[model samples]
Structures are given as structure tokens and as C-alpha cells.
Target chain A: MPYKYIGRTHSFKGKTLWEIVGNLKNFGVGRLVVRNTVVERYPEPSYYRILKVETLPQPKEESLDNLRKVKVLLEKTFRGVTNPKPVCIESASYKTDYRLIPKDEEQRYCQYKAPVTNEKIFPSTMELPPLMKEVLIREMKIKGEPVVEPVMDIVYNDKKRRIAKEGEKPTIEIKIGLGKPAALSLYKGIKLE
Target chain B: MFALNVISKTLNLPATKSAVNFQILRWRRKPRWVPIAKSKQFRIPQRPVIIEDEQIELKRLFNNYRTQMKSIKRYIVERFVAARAITTDPKDIQRIFDEDFARCNKINDEWNSDIQSKRIEYFENTLEENINLAKESLQKRLELEQFKLEEAEKIVTEQKELSKTFITADNIDEAIERSLANPVDYNFAVDLDGNKFYNKKTL
Candidate 1:
């Protein structure tokens, strides 16, 4: 070998976005590019289709080896789920971890099935704290009102894509108690009774 | 002692006056602009070595943690989406707001009425106290005025009694004649035998 590496090696395998897009015809518009790190995590394909490209001006004192950022409009598909809207990729373009997918493999890339996750149904209500439950029952009894089970509805944050799918059995059950530990070593010498 | 003086001089600090040499040590990282030392540039950090059993256990624990975290995150996101889906009519929202405002206003009005009653009673009490104070001061002022008038009248009466003896322009000639008529010899002296001399010249 010509030389052996002495210092810590980097995990980056692809060129910077600018290096690949800058050399292409029409700045590689209508081309597919994928991040290797994302592909390594998921089995399904995750990629970006370039819709527009804008090259940023380089600073006069910057060295040639320094990474340059480029603004690119892209239609992103992550883990085979395509985002309805086009997104702009700017700050992350300087990362030297993007690889261009060839034109011939675009069809094969699209053919990969999107992974489906089972629906999770969380409980509609959770029990009140022990002290609060007792207090509420006492108050209701004093007021001569019918005392029902003291439970509060579980409130959730509002989002566009919900993980709790409709018309499906929940994959995991959420019980109102102390959760079970993953391993007994985590508890160590603690008593569980 | 010699080293302390040198150090103080180099640092431009005040000279140490006592035997004890107190040096301030800075506990902080180097500034970002300062370049790494040449000796440390080529040094590689050693990776931590773990036993195979511990490594496996840690991996299992980490996987379990990640899976649980992912499920919790997904659940929160789904709940958020479902919450956002619920939409209420603007008219219904307005009605609810109106009802809430009316209830608040009623309570506020009741509080205002209670405070107003207390304020009215306080004002009445203060006004009664002020009236009594004014009456007392007026009575004292009237008594003082009466005393002053009585003193002035007495002085006028005394001056009227003494007016008969006072010389005026009209009685100047009569007063002078009376004074001349009443003149007496003041030159007489008494001898050893108690003899009285009417005038020394005559004696």
C-alpha cells in the first residue's frame, strides 16, 4: 500500500452535493440522489428528486478543499413514503454524504414496496392519581351527586400524519400501572413485590 | 519569595506583601482560535474496550430503549394528528365565548356591588366624622371670637373712663390755667430745732 492511515477514519462515503450537482448537465435537475446513511438504516428506498438547483457563491478567502453549500428544491421520499410537497435542502447540502442514483435504476428504486406499520390504539382515558381520585369521590358524595369512576381523557398533540391508524387493532397495549422493565439487570437488587 | 516577586512582576499584579504566595489558577478550556498543540495533532483516541457479554447486554438495552421511544413518539404524533382533525363551527365557538363572558361579567358585577356597598358605608362614616370635626372647630372659633370681643370692649370702657383727664385742643387754655393755679414753693428746709423755712432767701 502507498500509505497507511494513522488518524481516525471518517464514515462518509459519497461526495458533497455541490461536487456531484455542479458537474452535471443543467445542474442535475430531474435527477435522483440518496443519502447513504439513511439507506443503511432502513430497508426501503429513501431519495430526493431534484426539481431546481441554485449554486451559492463561494467566499474569496475560502480554500478549494472547503465544503460549499447549494440550495436545491427536491421531492423527498423517505423509507418509500413520498412527501406530498416539495422541500428545499440548503444547510445539509454542505454535508459530503450524498450519492447520485443512475438513471437506469430509477424504475427499480420505485418498485420497492413501502413498509407498513401496524396501528396503535392508545386508551381513551387514564386514571387520576390515587389521592385525587379519593378526593373527587368524597366531594361527589358530599354534594349528593352520583360518583362514577374518576378517569381523565388522554390528551394528545395535534399532527398531520397520525401514528394511531383508524380501524385497526393496537399492536401494543397501554395499561394503567407501573410499566414492566426490559431486563431484570436494570432493577438489580430492588424488590418488585 | 524571589519566584513570587518575579511572577507578580511578569503578570503585572500587585507585589506580594506577605510570606504566602497566592496564585490564581484558571480552570477553563483553551479559546477556539488557539491551534491544537503539534504533539496532540497526530494522537488518536483509543476506543473503549467492553466485554462481549456486557456489549451484548448494552446493545439489547439500547434497542429496547430505541423501540420504546419510537413507539411513544409515534403515539404522540398520531394523537396530535387526530386532535387537529377535530374542527368546531365558528358560530358555536362564538356562542361558547359569549356564554363564558356573560358568566364572568355576572360574577364581576356581584363583586362590584359588594365593594360598592362597603365604599358607600366608608364614605358616609368619613363624612359624618368630618362634619363633627367641623362643628367642634367652629364652636371653638366662635368662643375665641367672643373672648376677643369681650377683651376689646373692656379696653374701650377703660379708655372712656380716662378720657376726662386727657388734654384736648378745646381744653388746652383751661388745663394750663389750672396747672398754674396749683403751683407750690419747693425751696423750704428744716433746721435742728425743727423750724420750717418757707424760702431760704427770706430766712
Candidate 2:
């Protein structure tokens, strides 16, 4: 009799990291592995280069299909940018979502350039609120000082990966009013009054 | 009771229902220890289908939204860091502290002066009120003393007038001789017309 499949189907497409590394010589070191879920989300090439792999002792009672953690050192390159640091893949090693890239395709994957776009410029300063501006102007007049239009300086915090870029000519202006809506259909049949 | 029962039957009145005690079980997955049901062992769940165009559009919208959100988050973080950033220079910190202290001191001085003026006014008003109260109390005491002196003088004058009738040692013989010559009688009878009749004994 033919065997019947049980339960809801999983979305995982590729074998687990151990399934491929355990069979290969030298634990599949110096090999490229890609996650299908990451590829589905990003159009850019994203893969992990296995540097080292270590198999953990399996429990006597538990089956091989049960979750087992394996330590693996990986050099990850996501969205065409290679990370400078080596990352350890342990908990996710049990997930059956990693696929080893073929030797022939590795050269083609390495040939693609990192996508570059024009740097985005943000406003260096923002205008003060209307009431605040009025109050500042009145105070300046009372002090007999030259009245200048009060504006607040825009400051950016440093981050590991910053989306905002520094460049001449600001493309984006930070303002203190209702901005133009992105979708017109969402605002249909609505009146401002 | 029989008539009531007949009326209830005619009206088709419904019986009162009692509250039910029950436990509401929530929908959840079976525990890991529980084996799969025999009938559902071979059952497979259907995958959701999505249109290619709609998927592409959603992806693009999500990408744009993520980029915008990242930029906004970075901007907000940068603004917060800038606002909270402290000068490393001790001189700058000291200068700032001094300026703040001076401003606070000036405000404090202004408040103190305002309160001082009010306190002075309050003290002057209270002092005048206390003096007026003392004066009124002293006047009342003086009037009371004068009234007591007059009452004492009236009592003394009445006592001096009554002292002349008092029998002294020097007037004893004359008082006895006058008493002998008068032979006073104390027993008397009065009629309804208030006429008194004295009964005298023959000596």
C-alpha cells in the first residue's frame, strides 16, 4: 500500500544546513548556502558562505527529525553587501530552508555588482511652529534685538545602517503641516472642511 | 390558582428559564503529546493563492513603506541624540550651571521681595489692631474700677447714717433712763380697719 502524507504542508523548500553539510567532505566548508525565504523577499542575491561546521551530539531517545542545534560559522552577504563580521548560525540550523549553491553558479553570483542609487538629501533645518515663531518675534522686539525668523535645526542620530544620506540640495523637506496623501482612493469621499 | 393557570394557558405564556453553567473552550491547536486524529491524519491544508500583479504591487508598496519608515526613524533618533547630547568640556558645563543658577537666583530674589513687602504690610496692620485692642481693654478696666469705687462709697455712707442709732458706752445711762420713762409695750391687736389697740398693765 502507498504511504499517506499527514498534516498541513510546510513552506520550506530546501534541506536543512546539516543535511547538506553532514554528507559533504570537510563539513561543506567554503560553500555557499542561500535561504529560499530570503530570496523570495529580496530581488538581490543573498547567501551565506560556510566557514566551519560542528555537529552536536544527538539525544538517544529523540528522533533525527527533532530539532538539533549545530554551530556553523558563516560569512553573510545580504542585498549585495557583504558583512564585515563573521556570524554564527546555531538555532536556525534546524530549519529546513537552506540550499547549497552549485560551484558553477557561485562565480555568476559573485559577478553581480551592489546596486547603487543617488544619495538622498534631507532638510538640515525645519521651520518653527506658528505660535512659537510669533512668541519669539514678540520677545525679540521687546528686547530691542534684531528679529530673525526662528527655525529649528534638524539633527540626525548616528546609526549602524542609516537610510538618510548627506548631500547638497535636499530632496526631502521636513515640514510642520499635513503632507500630501500617498493614495487618493483611501481619502475618497472625504472633505477637509 | 386554577383560574390563573387557565389564563396563563390561554395567553400562551412562556416558562422562565434558569441560567446555564458552562465552560467556554477556546479554539487552539492540540498539545504536542496528543497524536493526530485518525480521520485528519491524511488531510492537507490548502495554500492561499495570490495574483502576480497584486503581489508585485504589494511588494513595491512594502519596499517604499520600509524605506520611508527607516528614514523617519533615523531622523527621529538623530533629533533625540542631538537634544540630549552633553558638552564634554567641564568649562562649558560650569558656564551653563552658573547661568542657570543666576537666573534662578534672580527669580528667587524677586519672589522674596514681593513676599517681604506683603509681610511688612501685614505686620503694620496687625500691630495697629493689637494696640487698639489693648486701649479698649484698658478703658473697660478703668470704668469697672470707677463703678466698684462708687458702689463702695454708697455702702459706706449708708453704714455711717446707721451708726448714730447704735447704743454706745457713753449713751448707756441716758438710753436706759429713756427706756424706763417710755415703758414700751410690744403686744398689740389690730382690727380689720387697721386700728391698733395696745394692752397696758397697771404698775
Q: Count the backbone clashes (under 3 Å) in each candidate.
A: 6, 2
Q: Write candidate 2's Cα lDDT for A106-141 as tens digits.
A: 989767775678656666666665776798799889
Tell me model 2's lDDT, rounded to 2 decimals: 0.77
Candidate 2, CAPRI quality class derived from DockQ:
incorrect
Best by lDDT: 1
| Per-model TM against the reference | 0.44, 0.45
What is candidate 1's lDDT per residue for B58-171, written digit by digit as tens?
776665455444544565576579966634998978987899999999999999999999999999999999999999999999999999999999999999999989999999
TM-score of chain B of each: 0.44, 0.48
Model 2, span B55-138: residue lDDT tens: 665665665455445555565576689978889899999999999999999999999999999999999999999999999999
List ranges where model 1 is wrong by over 4 Å. Answer: A1-13, A64-66, A115-117, A158-172, A175-193, B1-203
**Chain A TM-score of prediction number 2:** 0.70
Across residues A16-53, which tens digit of lDDT does each residue of candidate 1 receive? 89888999999999999999899886788899999999
